[model samples]
Target: MDTMLTDIPGMATYLDDIIVMGSTERSFMGSTERSCQVLNRVLEYGFQLREEKCIFMHSTKYIGFISDKNGRRPDHANIEAIQNMPAPTDVPSLRSFMGLTSRCSTFLPGMHQARGPLNELLSKDKPW
Candidate 1:
């Protein structure tokens, strides 16, 4: 990974995602070009590039967050999923949905407070 960093300057790695920061400088003589060159080298060495997953220039998604020079924030997909999830009809379904949304509870203000009802449903005495 250090080799990747040294080779792909301006490229930041967070787990599986690789963020390639862009520059206004000319492509032939800029950090962006150099970054691309390094990426090519890494590809030659057997690393496969998933073009569909790659984001150049603009902000990119990493982990469960969206990141850029400005900073990182929770990804909108997390919000959308929570907002669009169907109202739970049973304990099992509610638990499953809660498990998924819990991953981003930090972004959900007062999530601890909201868990009370869900917890009641999860109690062993509550059957599916």
Candidate 2:
């Protein structure tokens, strides 16, 4: 499958799902065209695509984030979960919160600085 789509920019496949993306208006048009090329290639290779699962010209959720030309943001549901999380009262709980936050770190600015104090608590010598 990788070899099949390798020639198309901004195309990615995982298992059987394929996602096409473009980061700007210029590339978005190209992305649309490339999707057609993908469809033709799928036919050429005797693979079938479910039309119901296919989406076009819209920001779509992939992995844990939603992305568009403006770039990716953490999914709102994920953000809400993190926001509603109770403040961590112990090392283990803090670690849990940090782990979740780390998954969205790309959307967070100054993450290292923001987490400095919490990270200190995780140190062996810090004492619970």
Candidate 3:
């Protein structure tokens, strides 16, 4: 995976998945062609292309997120999970939410400060 990105030109890998970013002169057909070319090369080298796992357009899913020229961000399913979180009525629930948020806390604004209040919920005498 590391070699696929660092050693190869025009190829990028995220874990087992691959992304072939299009050139400046972008079009759906051009991107699809580029994807096919890359996939062919990959297969020629004995790596199999998982068609079901491949995406070939700007709007296609990548790394569990949809990306385009505009920018990349979390998809609706991730947003829905955040929206549906139960209110942290106690320490255990707060801790669970903290664990989930901690995974992406580096991307979160005011995460350290916001965690101050949440951390208080985990005090020894607090109800679990």
Badly placed stretches (over 4 Å) of model 2 are 1-18, 23-26, 29-57
Residue-by-residue lDDT tens digits, candidate 3, 1-128:
54644444455676676665544335433556665776666776667776687555656565446666655556667666666998888777787888777755756789899998788778888654
Q: Compared with the true structure, what per-residue lDDT tens digits does model 1 show for residues 30-61? A: 65567568667667666777779754555667
Q: Poorest 10 consecutive residues of model 2 by lDDT?
A: 24-33
The number of clashing residue pairs in each candidate reads 0, 0, 0
RMSD of each: 6.3, 4.7, 5.4
Instruction: State the local distance difference test value for candidate 3.
Output: 0.65
| Cα RMSD of predicted structure 3 | 5.4
Supply candidate 3's per-residue lDDT for 35. Answer: 56
Cα TM-score per model: 0.51, 0.60, 0.51
Best candidate (score: lDDT) = 2
Higher-scoring candidate on lDDT, 2 or 3: 2
Candidate number with the higher TM-score (1 or 2):
2
User: What does candidate 3 score on TM?
Assistant: 0.51
